[model samples]
Every structure is written in structure tokens, then in C-alpha cells.
Target: MNIKNTTSIFVDCHVFDSGFQGTRTYIQGLYSELIIKRDLHFFLVSSNPDNLASIFGNHSNVTYLKYKYENKYLRLLIDIPQIIKKHKIDFAHFQYTVSPFKRCRYIVTTHDILFINFPEYFSFFSKIINTFLYKQSAKWSEIRLTVSEFSKQKIHQHFGFSNYEITPNAIDNVFFEDYDKVLIKNEVAQKFSLKKYIIYVSRWEPRKNHQMVLKAFLDLELYKEYELLFLGNDTLSNPQYNEIFSQVDSEIKKKIFTLKNTDFNTMLLLLRGADASVYPSMAEGFGIPPLESVAAKIPTICSDKTAMSDFSFFEDYYFDPHNQIDFNDKLQKILKENLGTDFKIMAQKIKEKYSWKKSVEIVYRLIKQNQ
Candidate 1:
């Protein structure tokens, strides 16, 4: 350690340029707090250094570095290791996988090992490769972390990684800000030409259960009054969603919209304008969208599967992702029954329970101990 009493750390920031996703959210939320501490020096590296700088403003303890190679292996093996040595980093934190050749004390947060538990959702090869890389990364790390108790348990059971702490995702305070919903909706309707709508914010993947959400929207005939908006980038092929859309009438099809890779501010505007939010993902490390919806004070119906079950505040709104009937009943009730009063009650609980400040502090403490 240096005489200055500061612990230098390197953070892999490649995920920031990959658009809005869970991992990006985790890193941005965690470090936005960690970088404020004068005792900790953070070297954040990415291909897009400008975007990193814009997100995280200047601080005395913070530094932004850029990646040389676009290739994953080269960046991991050559670029990062060299940076660690040059900067004299005391510790390095990686999202899921760490550099194979360690240059400093490594801290890895394998957000989840979902493939090990829900083998059907992931491909055979993906499962094999990720299991190997993630397991090895955990094994090499001096301290390990994950997003939820469910994820922590899965890691231990599958990879025998016992030295891990859960640093869960929390709803950002921006979502809870008091904004006039009618005005936001009116602006959204004018700008995007969107009418009364329900929202589902997740990438298009079979495991994310997009098809089921589409089916429920169609079956319930809610489109007559509300447009169904699927907001996210497509990652995997969902043949079922295609098949369902093909059979539906043109008017019914017109009522459903898919907005891809919109900026974060637009996402928030759309979320605020939503009549309701539906998150029916089959599995998750820690479900952020549902919590975000609750924070936005919108009536949300979420799946009670995997880590999402921890969001027990959505009790009446919870449904089985695999069961269409259960989802239908809950969805029907959430929309028909005005839940404004209920939202206030749920919002208080959500705010009180989870916080990015709390989550990030725990992670920082763990890293400082190991550093």
C-alpha cells in the first residue's frame, strides 16, 4: 500500500457502450457512489471514454482510461493487465469475468449463474463456456460478489464459490421523483404518437419471456384501450412472438409497438407515461424493471420466479411466468382496478427496503478490506 492511505482500483467499463442493460446499470449505480470517497482511487476503462466521462463526472479520486483492442481476449489478456501494472492498481473489479492472468488483487461480481439453474433458457455451448469462465473468475478473485441472495446461492451450489456477498440492485431515486403523469403522457403522446399504453422494458430474448407477455396482451384484448409497448434491443430469436404477430389482425398489430435502444431519458419518460408496467421474465439475477416500475408508482405485475420472488411487495401483482392463466388474472386486475392508493403504500416500502447507496457501500467496504 502507498503512504497516502488511498487504495487504487481498476474497473472494467466495456459494458457502458453496449447500450442499456442490467450489467451497465449495476456498474453505473455502484460506482457513482464509490468514486466520491477520497480514500479510493478508481480507474474506469472502456472503448468509449467520452460516454464514461459524461456518465461519471470528474472527481479527484477518479480516472478514465480507454481500451486498445476491440477483441475480448486481447483486451483481457493484454490491454487490462498492462494498464493494471502501469497504474499500480491495488485491486481490480470485474463484472462477471476477470483477466485470466491476474495483475492485481481481483474482485469479481458474477451477477448470476442462471445457466446452471435454468439450463433450458441458455444454449449448451453458452452454458459450458460461461460456467468455465465465471467459475474460474470466482476462483481467482480475492473477494467475490453477486447481485442477490438467489444468485449468491446459485453460485455456491454450482461453482462452489462460498466467499461471496450479495450487492443487490436498487431502484434509482430518479424514478421516484414526483412528476405530473398526465403532462408526461401528453408530451409522450404528442412526440412519439403513442396513446394510452402498457410497458415491458427488457431485451427480446426467449428466456426474458417476451412472447408470453405478447400473448397475454393479445388474449386479454387490452389493446382496444391501451397500446402494448415492448421497449428494448433484440438479443435472441423469438419465433413465437413472430408467429403470434403474423396471426393477429392488422389493427391489433398496430396497437403493439417495439422501440429498440432508445436513450435512458426517453425510457424514463415512457415509463412515467405508462398506464401499467408488466415484467414477466422467467428468471433474473435481481429484477430491476419491476422495482423501477414500483418506484415510478405505476401498477406493475411481475413474475414470481428466481430472484424476482424477493420483491414480495408486489404480492397481489405477482404471477407465474409459465402460467398464462395466472398472468391473465393478475394483469386484468392491475389494469382495471385503479391502484393509485396501493402504489403509494408499495412505493414507501420499495424505497425503504432497497437503496443504491446502501448496496454500493457494502461492496466498497468488502473491496477496501481485501485491498
Candidate 2:
């Protein structure tokens, strides 16, 4: 299968080692399609090549490579460059950060400059370091890409070089499939002992606005009927969310549960079984969970802020994240099963516009043109 003149592409798949995040979804979704092309060969790098193999399955054009060093800097400075040279890779793709030293033609996707815009949510050291590193990464790449128009604008406005292309995230096909709600709900209830619940799927951070949604659930008294599920891993410290959670009545607190480190399928099943979903995050690069919830036909209330503003598709369901009253009103409507917009119609529009198939085609064409 060594087709001569095939373009060789090296994908930095370290995100696979980190579970259940947007970057992992993006890499898996995009390259899952890209690996099928006969004229292109993919070298996917991660700490766990066996796990990567399991996820991507057997493909002639795909080769899974393991990292020699566990440290990110050592892998970037030493391991990745060695792999690029050994494989004679024509292009290397990275998320956010890239190797400072030149090796071959490089492509980078800086997902967002959120820290620069929402400096209050970030540490001073983080903001200072990322501002320089992210700018350098974008500057170093042969092609620069981002997840949404909002991110592209932010990158352009701040970074000033302004050539970043948009590679928006797509919903996984599983979310769109028509599953029996009764059957799924029964299975979810039996497996997890969750009778009725509302979910917020995101990695925990200050900017994610977990407290706002948590407060709304209590004030709206939806907790009386449904459990509030906080389903996400802790990335950044969200002390504000905790302070509010700590002050809640113990009886009401009993109805709240926090879940972390759920595998992809488990997350999907839980999401599909929800009474409703709320994405009240104050900041985002390209918010994926709200769309996923909507695609699963879950009644969803999304925050109309930052990058999420582009998701006008949520229509009347979009509410103010900062306003507790607005959050509560929207949450109450969805909890009462008042799905304002026709979700089926909205979901179709999402499928048509945002898909890995379409995204990969654009990326492939761009690569071919640049090459």
C-alpha cells in the first residue's frame, strides 16, 4: 500500500490520552475521515499508541506512533521532530502550541485566546505565558486554523497576522441517531440509578459558569423534580462554583451530583437521558456540548456569550449567562418541556453546515492548494 507520491501528514494526537474534551473530538472527528484518503498517509502521535489504534481502528493509510518521553516539552523538542524526520512528513498538525524549532511544514490550530479576553478568570502567569506562546505558535505555522468565527476574529484582532482559518467542531453521528427514549432512559436509570436529571457537560472552570446554572436550578425549584448533574472533569479551579454549592441546603444538595472522567459513550447515554441540558458557560472558543445536546433532541438552554453568540440557532433558548433571572426563566421553560424552537428543524440545519466530512474536505483542499 506504499502508494508513491502520497502526501504524508503527521497528526499530534496527544489529546486522545486526555479524555472527553473538545480537542480530542476535533482530532478524532476530522482525522477519522482524513485517514480514509488513499493519497494521504497519517502518522498519529500519542503516549498510548495501542489506545489510539483501538479508537481509529485498522486503516492502511494510518500509523499510530507512541511518545518516547512523557514530558510535553521533551516530546515537542525531541520526540516529535524525530518522528517527522523518520517518516519524512510533509506536514505536521498541532493544537495551540508548536515546537519553536523548525522541522518541516507545520500547521497549528489555536482554539482560542480566551485568557486574553477574560483575564479575570485566568492567572497572571498563564495569561502572560499563553499570550506569547500562542502568538509564536500561530506565527510559526505554515497554516493557522481555529474552531469558530468568533475565535478567528479574536485571533485576528489580537494577534494581528490574521490568516487563521476556521475548522469548526461537528457533532458525532451517535447524537443524531434516533434512539428509543424510553429504552435509553431505562438503561441509564438502571446503570447509574439516575431517575430524572438535568446535565451540564463541560470541563469545570470559572468561565464555564457552572455556578449560574447551579443557582438557577435551585431557585427555579427544578431540583424538586430532577437531579442536577455536573458532568465534567476539573481542568481549572472553579472555587466560585464550590462556594455556591457549599451554601445550598443539604436536602437540596442531595439532589445534585458531580460526575467526572466519564468515557465518551457513557457521557452520550447520560446526555440522551436528560430532562434538559444547560450550557451556561461565559466564555468559549467554539462550544460543542450545547449543539450535541440539541442534536440528541434534549431540551437545551445555551448562553449567548462570546463564541456562543454565533450559535443563534438556539433561538429563544439562548439566555444571558450573567443574569441569574434570565438563566432561571430559560431553565424553568425547558424543565416544563417548553422547547421553544423546533429542535428537529434546527438540528438538521446544524448537520448540513457543521460536519467532519465537510470540515475535512476544506482542510484537505487547503493542504493540497498550499502544497
Candidate 3:
């Protein structure tokens, strides 16, 4: 096999330290696949190199670089450039956006321009800083890669550029693994005190549209038949959660429960055992939870905007993200319909359609072309 420009590729693995779930999953999947490729050398840089190294090490072509800084912005502006030049890297792939200055040709993954589109979701300081960095990376990177076609279009609309490629996110086969349904279901029910539950599995935040999900559940009176299981961090520190919680009556509040920092297998079991899975996010880059739910062979309802549409094929599975009436009707329909076979077929197609191996291959080829 002929490989073009056998130059070392530097990947910023700082995402591990940031505690962002979706970004970490994307980078970890790509990092795992890329390490196994034969024709390229990789420099994995992070403040927590030991953690990443334990996963991506044991390969002759992969080198681990560490930087000591507690602050993300300081590490990016100061530490990353110094490390890139010190290693003499030819191409650097930033898992998020790029540093303002560059020592080499670089590629950036603009996951989504959510801050630009929904500025209200972020604080004023965060919005100002992130918008500037995102625009710069989109404007100046050697190659811009986004997770979904929807994001590519949004980036173009926001940044006035269309020179980017869509690399798309994929589900790991771990989600598709066979498990003892009876045993796992019993365990999940006991742990969460759940009985006939419908699940929502994402970080609780405004952009996730948790308020709308709660409102719809309350309006439809689904709480009478099924409890709502929230399967992620409660994020109590976020003022949004407090505001939403204050509006709920104590009776309605008792029906909702949150389980934070769940183990991966347990989370999968919850999805598998759910009567139905609902993902009502207002925006997303690739919408992993809906895909995970579908992969678990659960009847899945998703917001009909952004990349959630790519995960669920049936029209009945989607509802307007902004409208509670649309969500309630769809949620009712999914529960009322016999859709198990339909969900299984869609899961098989989604599994085939999104592959980490294929996504990494595209990234590899792009890196070679730029090199």
C-alpha cells in the first residue's frame, strides 16, 4: 500500500479533561480506530496523557505528549502550540476547534455551531468566547470537518463558507451487544425504582429541551401509566434546571427521577428495558442517544430537527422540537403502536450506515490529502 506524505499526526486529547460526553465519545472512537492504522504516526497530546495512553498506547507509531495546565484556554493558547512545534508535527487534528495561531497545517472538527444559533443556552461570556474561536477555526483550518450534514449547512450559513466535509458520528458495537434482558431489566428497575418507565438519556440542559419534555409528559398525563426516568447528570448547578423544577407541582415532581453518572452497561440496559426512549433536544451535531436507543431496539421518539432525523427513519418517530402538542401526539402514537419489528429493522440499517472504521477512514484520507 502506498501512503502519501508519511508525516506525524498530532491529536489534541484534551476532551477527556473537559467532561463533555458527546465530544469524548467521538474522539475516543476515532482515536481508537486511527491508532490501529498502519501508514501513519500519531502524537496524542493531553493534560491527562496517562489516561489516554492506557487506551491508545502499545503501538510503535503512537507517541504520548503531556502538558501540565489546569486551565483549558491557557493550555490551548500556550501549551498546545509549544508541544506541536517541539514534536515537529506536520498535521494536527483538533478534536474541537483550533488554537488561534498554528505551527502546522491543521484540521478542525466543528461539532456544531450551537452557540451561534442558540446564544440563549450559553452565558454571555461563554457565547462571546466560543463564537470567536469557532468562527476562526471554521474560517482558517486547512480542512474543516463536521459531524453531520445539518451542521455543515449551519456552519456555511453562519460562517459563509462551504468548503467543509461531513465525517458523521457512529455508534460503537458495544451498544448492539446481546444481554440477558430479563436479568438486566430487573436490575435496572430495582436500582432506579422504576415501574413501567419511559426514559430520557442525555445531560439535562436547556438545549436538551428538558422543559418541553417535562411539559409534554405532564400534559399527556403519561405519568399516570409510566414514570419518567432521567438517565444522566441532573446538573443542579445550572440555573435552567432550578427554573424548570420550580414550576412543577410536588405531585408531578415526585413522578420524575434522575440517575446521574450511570455506568455504560447499566445505561444500555436502561435503554434496552425502556418502554420507549424519547430524545427531545432542540439542537445537536449527531444525536447519539436517539441512535443508541434505536440500536438498543427500543421504540424511539426524537426531535425532528438537526441530526436526530438521520437516526430515526420513520416519520412517526419525529416531532417538532419546539412544540409540546407535536411531541405528545407522537409519544402517544409510539406507545399505542406495535413498532418493535420496525425499530429492529431501523437499528440494523443504522448499525450498517454508521461505522467508526468507515468514519476514521474518511478522516485518514483527508489527513493524507492535506499532508
Q: Each model's C-alpha lDDT? A: 0.88, 0.88, 0.80
Rank by TM-score, highest first. Answer: 2, 1, 3
TM-score of 2: 0.97
RMSD of each predicted structure: 1.7, 1.4, 3.1
Query: Worst 10-residue stretch by lDDT in candidate 3?
Result: 233-242
Model 2, residue pairs in steric clash = none
What digit string (tens of lDDT, one per residue) describes model 1 on residues 288-352?
A: 88888888998999999999989888888899999999988998898889889888889999999
Compared with the true structure, the alpha-carbon lDDT of candidate 1 equals 0.88
* Model 1 residue 181 distance off true place after TM-score fit, in angstroms: 0.8
